[model samples]
Target chain A: MKNIWTIAKREYDNYFASPLAYVIAAGLLFLLGGIFLIILQGSIQQAIFGGGTPVDIGFINQWFYYLLLWTVPALTMRLISDENRTGTLELLLTAPVRDFELVIGKWLGSFLYILSVIGVSFIFAIVANYLAEPGIDQVKMMSSYLGLILIAGALLALGTGISALFNNQIAAFFVTLALFIVLWLLIGIPASFFPSNPAIGDVFRYLQIGNHYESTFNAGVLYLSDVIYFLSLIAIGLFTGVTAVDSRRWR
Target chain B: MIRVTDLTKDYGPRRALHSLSFEARQGEIIGFLGPNGAGKTTTMRILTGYMPPTSGEAIVAGYNVMEESIEVRKRVGYLPETVPLYNEMVVQDFLKFMAELRHIPNPEESVADALNMVGMTERAKGYIGNLSKGMRQRIGLAQALIHRPEVLILDEPSIGLDPGQVVELRKIIREIGRERTVLLSTHILSEAQQICDRVIIINKGKIVVEDTPENLQARLVGGERVVLRVRGDAAELSAKIEQVKGVQRLKSNPDGSLEFEYLPGHDVRPEVAKIITNGGYEMLEMKTLSLSLEDIFLELTKEQVVTPKKKRRL
Candidate 1:
C-alpha cells in the first residue's frame, strides 16, 4: 500500500511538474465556461417566458460528457507510455512492488487528474445555483456527477490499458480517442438494429456508457444495475490493464 | 551471494543465454565480460528477475529468481544499462520515493545516506534533467543504494561517461563492493581487469572462459612477447632479436619495429635490450608486451568464428 501511494504521489506530482496540468486545466475551464454561458442564456429565456427549470440539465450532461471523451484520452495517454518510452518501466517492474500496485497506482494518478478536470467543470454548476429561479435538482445533479465519476474511472482504466499497449504516447492518445469515439457512436445504435428482445437488447444497451448514465443516473435514480454495470466496466478495464502489464514478466 | 545453474533464454528462434552457470560469493565483485550480443545483459535480466529464464534457475541472496521473485527483488539493487530515471524528479525526492518503495524504516536517513555515499548530497535539490550525465549516473547509483540491498547488479555502469567520470564511478563502485556482493557486465575488458575479482567471458550466448584476469591472460597466451622500436634497419634488428636466447619466434613489423615471442619461464627483456644495442641498432623503445584480458577475449571469441564445421559444445 505504501509503495502504491508512493508511486501514485510521484505520478500525480509529475502532472504539475510540467506544463501539462496548466494546459489541461485551461482547456477544460475555457470550453466548459463557453458551454455554460450558452446553456445559461437558453435556460434564462425559458424561465422568463414559459416557467421552465433554471438550467437545461440534459443539455449540460450531453455536452460535458462529449468533451470528456476527448479530454480523458489527452490526460491518461502518458500514464504508462511515458514510462515505457523512457525505459523507466524497466525500473518500475524490477522493483518490489506487485503488478496490481503498479496498475492501480497509475490509474489512481490519472483518476485524480480527471477528477480535478471534472472539478473545474463545476464552476458552471456553482454559477447556475445563484442565478436559477427555483434552484436546480440537487439530488439529480449529484447523481449526474456520480455517473460522470464512475464512467470516467472506466474511461481512464481503458486509457491506462491502451497506454500500456504502446511505447509512444501519441499513438496511445490517438488510439484511445478512436476507441471512445466508436463506443460512444455505438451507444444508441443497438436499439435501432435489434427488436424488443430484452436479454440481447439489454446486454448491448448496458454495455454503452451513454445508455446507463443518460437513462438512469442523469435522470437522478441510482439504480443498482446501473451502478453494477459501471463497476463491472471498471473491473474489465483494469483486468485487461493488469494482463497487459503482467505480460512483460513472461518475456 | 548468488548462483545461476544452466540458465538459458531464447527470443523466438534466437538464443540469448545458453546454459550459463556462474557464482559470486559474499564481498566478491564478479565482472560479466562479453561482447555486446554475448548474453551479458540477458543473464543480468534473468538474475534480477526482469525476465524469467526459458529453462534452468537463478538464485540470488538465497532466494530463487523465478519462484521467489519478490524476495529476490527486495535483496537486489540493479542499475540497468540505460540508467533509467524520472527526469522531472529532484534527486532527494527520487531517493525518498525509492526508499518508500523499498519500505525502508528511516526514509530520511536512508535517502541522505545514499546521497552521501554517491557524493551527491549537495545536488539533492536539483532535478534529474538539470544534472550532468555523470551526476545522473551517480544519482542512479544512489537510488540503487537507498535500500542497502545485499547484492548489487550493475550493467555497463560506466557506459557513456567521460574517461574521468569513468574513473570516478569505478572508485565509487569499488567502495560499495567492499561489503556487498557486486556483479557488473561490460564489453571493456580493462574495466573488468581493474576491479573484478573474477571475470566471466562469454560469446555467442555461451560462457567461453571464467577465471581471474591475470590467470585468463596466462592461459590464453602462455608465451612472453616484447615489442621494440629501433632507429636502425629492421632486418638487421630482427636478425639480432632472433639470436637472443629463449626466443621462440621473431617477426619484423612493417614500420621498423621488432616483435619477439619467447619461451615461458624466462626473463628475455634484459637480454633483448642488450642484444639490440650491441647490434648498433640504437633501440628507441623497448617494452615487454604482457598478455591482457583483452587479448584472451579476442583469441577465445575469434576461435568461435573460424570453426564453422565444429559442433557447438552444449
Candidate 2:
C-alpha cells in the first residue's frame, strides 16, 4: 500500500513537471468552454421563442464525455511506455514494489489529473444556474458529474493497460484511441447488419459507454448495475495492465 | 551474500546463461568479466529479481530471488549497464523516491548519506537531464546506495565515464565493498585486476574460469611474458638472460627483440636489463605483457572450435 502511494506520488509529480499535462488540461477546458457557450445560447433562444422546458445545464457533460477519447489517451500513453523507453521500468520492477502497485499507481495519477481538468467545467453549471429560469438541478448535475468520473476512470484504466504493451508512445496513443473509438461507435452498428439477432444489438448497446451515462446518470437515475459496469471495466483494465508488466520478467 | 546454482536463462531460442554458478561473500568485490552478449546482464537481472531464471535458483542476502522477490529486492541494489534514471527529476528527489520505494524509514537521511557517499551533495538540487554523463552516472550510483542494501549488483557501471570519473567511481565502489558484497561486471581486464578481489570470466553464457586476477593470469599464461628490444645483437643478450634464474623458453621475435617467460612470483626484468647493458647493448625498450581478457577468449574459443570440428569429421 505504501509502495502504491509512493509510486503514485512520483507519477503525479511527473505529470505536472511535463508540458504535456498542462497542454491537455488547457486544451480540454478551452474546447469544453466553447461548447458550453453554444449550448447556453441555444437554451436562451428556446426560452425566448419556442417556450421549451428550462435548460438543464449539467447536460453539457453529455457532450464533454466524448472528449475523453482524446484526453485519456494523451494522458496515459506515456505512463508505462515512457518508463520502458527510458529503461526506468527495470528500475521500478527491480524495486520492492509489486506489479499491481505500479499499474494502479500510474492509473491513479492520471485519473486524478484528468479529474481536476474535468472539475473546471463546474463553471458551466454555475453559468447555467445564473441564466436559466429555475436554476440548475443540483441532483442531476452531481449524478452526471459522477457518471463522467466513473467512465473516465474506466477509460483511463484501459488506456494505462494498453500503454504497458508498447514501448513507443505514439503507438500506444493510437492503439488506445482506436480502441476507444470502437467502443464509442459500437452503439452505432446498424440493426440491418445483425438481422435475426436482436441480442447482438443489445449486447453492443450494453457495452457502449454512452448508453450507460445517457440513460442512468444523465437522467438523474443512479442504477447499481451501471455503477457495476464501469467498475468491472476498471477491474478488467487494471488486471490486464498488471499482467502485462509481470510478463516482462519471463521474457 | 549472493549464491547461484545452475542459473540458466533462455530468451526464446537463445540461451543467455548456461547453468552459470558463482557466489560472493560479504565484504568481497567480485567482477563479472565477459564480453558483450556474454550473459553478464542477464545474470545480474536474475540476481536482482528483475528477471526470473528458466531453471535453478539464486539466493541474495539470505532470500530466494524467485520465491521471495520483494525481500531480495529490498536487500539488493542494482545499477544496470545503461544507468537507467528519470531525466526529468532532480537528483535529491530521485534518490528520495528510490529510498521510499525500498521502504526506508528515514528517506531524507538516507538520501543525504547516499549523495555524500557518491560526492554528489552539490548536485542534489540539479535536474538529472541537465547533468553531464559523468554526473548522471554518479546520481545512478547514489540512487542504488539510497537503501543501503546488503548486496550491490552493477552491470558495466563505468562503461561511459571519463577516465577521472572512472577512477573516482571505482574508489567509491571500493569503499562500499568494504562492508557489503558487490558484484560488478566489466569487459576491461585492468578494471577487474584493479578493483575485484576475484574475477569470473564468462564466455557465451558459460563460465570459462574463476579465480583471483593474479591466479588466473598465472594459470592461463603459465607465467608472465616479457619482451626486450636492444641496440645490439640478440644472440648474446638471449644467452645471458636464459642464464638468469626462473627465465624459461626464450625466443627471438622477427623484430629482433628477445622474449622470455618466467614463472609466477619471479622478477626477471632487472636481471635481463643488466645483462643487456653489461653486454655493451643499450636496451631500447622492455615491457611485461599481462594476460588480457581477449587472450583468455582466444584460448577458450580455440578449444571450443577445434573439438567440435574434430568430432564432426569423425
Q: What lDDT is reached at residue B278 by model 1?
A: 76
Docking class of 2: high
Model 1 pairs in collision: none
Q: Put down candidate 2 lDDT per residue, A1-251, tens digits, no spaces.
A: 98888888888899989998889888888888888888777788664554556567655788778888777888899999989989999999899989999999999988888777778878888877767666667888889999999999999999999999989999999999998988788555763477789887677777878878987898889999899989998998899889999897778
TM-score of chain A of 1: 0.90
lDDT of each residue in B1-314, candidate 2, tens digit only: 99999999999999989998888999999999876788999999999999999999999999999999999999999898888899999889999999998889999999999999888899899899999888888888888888888999998889789999899999999999999999999988888989999999888899999999877776888777787788887887777788899998798877687778888788878887778777899978888776565566567645444443211100
Model 1 residue B238 CA deviation in Å: 8.1
Top-DockQ structure, candidate number: 2
Identify the runs in model 2 with alpha carbons over 4 angstroms from their true place. A42-54, A130-133, B228-260, B264-314
Candidate 2 matches the true fold with a TM-score of 0.88
